[model samples]
Target: MMEEKMEDRNKIKTELIVVIVEKDMSGEVIDAAKQGGADGATVMYGRGSGIHENARFFGITIEPEKEIVLILVDAAIRNAVLCSIQKKIEIDRPGMGIAFVLDVAKVIGSPHLNLMSDITD
Candidate 1:
């Protein structure tokens, strides 16, 4: 049936939202993402363990603070969401943060329905 085919198509395409923000800017980044049409997001705090020698300060340890924000959106609005967060959070600045997107194969839950409804319109 057409409905089954449409559902199968929807199941194949997904938006992956990845945001790496300074620990202090996580809240602002998440708020910007929400304003940009993200239905929900997950935030995790972590310390940067980059192997770059320059990543450290004057012989003392310089641990870069980090927060990772993950939001799974419908494919259509992924770019807009990324741009909105970038604009509001100034992610392009040095040591500020970074955000990227990926393709998702499938997802499970009622939340996907809500996201699909919101993004389709």
Candidate 2:
């Protein structure tokens, strides 16, 4: 008979950076992520509807085109990547856009994730 043991997956932590910015500046955003040590990024188009305020003309709606960037990076370089993006995009300024990081408990499909974890560890 063979015995099997389960691994503790919680020990591995990853960061998912969600960045929303001007559609035309998505290339810059991805560049920032790469400069910050991110291996890859995914970008998508979207529209903004934040609580800040909205302008209207003739009782019509106006929405700004946005690019949503998704970057999954190793926990070790998460902060550095975010800072790099901030410096290049001036994320601190109003109307620039919003960015946030989420805790990724698990990831799949990316074979290099293990290599990343090992290097960071």
RMSD of each: 5.5, 5.5
Looking at model 1, report the run of 10 residues with the lowest lDDT sum.
112-121
The residue-by-residue lDDT of candidate 2 on 1-121, one tens digit each, is: 1111113333557789999997698899999989999987999998888866466889997777889999998788999999999999998899898899998866656655552222223
Q: lDDT (CA) for every model shown?
A: 0.74, 0.80
Stretches off by above 4 angstroms in model 1 are 1-12, 50-59, 112-121
Q: Count backbone overlaps in model 1.
A: 0
| lDDT per residue (tens digit) for residues 23-54 in model 1 | 77878877887888877788898887656412
Q: Scored by Cα lDDT, where does model 1 land? A: 0.74
TM-score of candidate 1 relative to the true fold: 0.75
Listed in order, each prediction's TM-score against the native is: 0.75, 0.79
